[model samples]
Target: MGKKIILLLTVGVLAAYYVYTPLPDNIEEPWKLTWMIAVSKTVAYLNLFSEFLGANRFVNIAALSKRQEVPPTSDENVTVTDTTFNNIPVRVYVPKRKSVALRRGLFFIHGGGWSSGSFALYPHDFLSRKTAERLDAVVVSASYRKAPKHLFPTQFEDVYNSLKWFLRQDILENYGVDPKRVGVSGSSSGGNLAAAVTQQLTEDPSVKIKLKTQALIYPILQILDMNTPSYRENSHFPTLRKSEVAKGWYDYFTTDRSLENAILLGQLVPAESSHLFKFVNWSSLLPEKFKKGHIYKKPIHGSSDVAKRFPGILDVRAAPLLADDARLRGLPRTYVVTCQYDVLRDDGIMYVTRLQDAGVEVTHNHVDDGYHGAFFLLDLKISHRIINHYIDWLKENL
Candidate 1:
């Protein structure tokens, strides 16, 4: 047993050596950042091997391998309520301070590659609490059933239903939220859902409640292109990597691990999806700056069999970037943050550009030194700087 543990550590050290996780001079406190990145990747690697040590499967309950499902209460600055909406668990955080009138409202979704975010939504994170107190807004965070344990549309359905419930007139009024001034936001995978839910509301004639604003922090907007410049450059950046993310998407779509290799080869989308290129094709939508001269080639349509087994991958609810102009046009005022060294960076870049082309108002901040999920490193100065900027945007838009 002792030898096995040493062998695993040695293997991890060697794996770390082969991967390209370098500290770019562009970033601040490079050594500290590298340490955090190393720890994050190592923990995730360990989680995958935990079965040997009698630990529960990491991807089963929460994306982070965390088992905490019990909701937590914040200190005096915020009032916390644990409840359900549309039969889905949610935590509402409202500032305890006195306000001039009804405050703004924000519907937030957490990210974990569609799996890890399951456990942290219930008033357990810092950003949501700060948003409620600092922006003087009522915030609701939904605990969507994650993938692998659940499945694709299930996570989307939970968020969509919960947002629809939050939009209810009485619900907003009860929380002292101004229905006229509400918005939605998320980071990474949650950001994808925020964009999808906003687009969904815009298209649904029955949903009269149009959101006022949206903010996406390093969001993964589509599954079509993993060869974007960021993916090629930052393939080994810590926390989120291209190969790992591709697998997460495949897992979210199906239980079969066998077909995921096809996803990596970029053929899992099948040939029929070529029609979606005009909307989500990064070659057309991404700015020349992001391209870095890598010409976009549509993934060859070679996996009709895999695509047929599960067609949900291309559903607009799963990949909001695939929505057409009519759906994109009515979207709310937007704020997008993209990191230079993150595999999914281009997802936000193309999305905000498309939103602008459709006449939706937009505010964008491209963090040159940033990597994916930077704000998740709560203790780091760079992370807090990004979070503060996001909160300030909420102050203006919400």
Candidate 2:
């Protein structure tokens, strides 16, 4: 019996090791990234067993969490409040150190393709807490309902509405935050929401808060041009690929999954937008350095039938890249981080050029060794270096 048990355990370990996706030497922390991807993929395959057993999966990928757990790590000088505003959950982090003046404020949105990540997750908690302690600012790590279950605009509404609640004078004062010194930030899909929310807040008349800055780390700025230079180059990048990221958006916005394969080839935009594409085509916004000599061909429109199903992907709120020049000009000072080996690399680069053209102050850090999901785990020096870069920028801007 003991020999059989040992044999079974060895086989399981060997299987997990064997299935790890190979990584190129150029990626950030290749070994660690491979291990993390292996674990996530293993969990994903294990989930398929539930379908065969005629029951829901034993684990909910969207809801996988351990809110009360804290791993052994550095930095313990922040106090956290797991609370809610406007009925949306938020994890607030305030530096424990005493201060005479109100500190800068930041709203952090966690990202797992907009369908995963939460305050219950440790990476987010650590990042938010570390931000508060390092920058000596108050950080509100907000949570929104996930997608495919909640549908489009609900997550946006939740984040924006709760933002309104947080910006109230009473709440800002109570948290030792300066209303005039507040900024927004997020990672990946959270980066998408942070950018969209920052753009929408520019037009909001009901909220008196003036955003001081925005930091988008590997944000998904547009849904249309899946054929951008980085997209062509990094579609096969580990963990977050071109199709997997678009699939999350598709699942979140609509019930139909047929658009999955078509959208991957940049074929989902409505045919009626030819006049609009001239302004947004790769030639206009993206810089030549980012183009890397890739010839610019206009996107092929999806069939009218394919276009009819997901008409809203082009909405500025859904794809901040679609926002008008006037609105983009009105945005606040911006900070953007792009990983060289990421599908979203061109998204950040294009936005930086667009924002700079509109006279908005911009700070961009292009990490040559970075890839998508690089700092998400916070298990390497490279991740901390990225965090420090943001901290230094926040010190100057916020």
Clashes (candidate 2):
0
Q: Tell me the tens digit of each residue's lDDT in model 2 across 167-198.
A: 99999999989999999998888888999999
TM for every model, in the order presented, reads 0.90, 0.90
Q: Runs in model 2 with CA error above 4 Å? A: 1-21, 52-59, 66-76, 278-280, 303-308
What is the TM-score (0 to 1) of candidate 1? Answer: 0.90
lDDT of each: 0.81, 0.81
Could you tell me the lDDT of residue 353 within candidate 2? 83
Worst 10-residue lDDT window, candidate 1: 59-68
Rate residue 69 of model 1 by lDDT. Answer: 46
Tens-digit per-residue lDDT, 1-398, candidate 1:
99999999999988768453677888877767777766766666677678667776644335454544445576789987778999998888889889889999999888888877652543235778888889988889877886788898998999999999999888887888888899999888899889888888877877767799999989888877677778888887766778878878977888888767776776656667678766667787878888888977777675677767877767888888888887888888999999998998888888888889999999999999888878777767788889889999889878
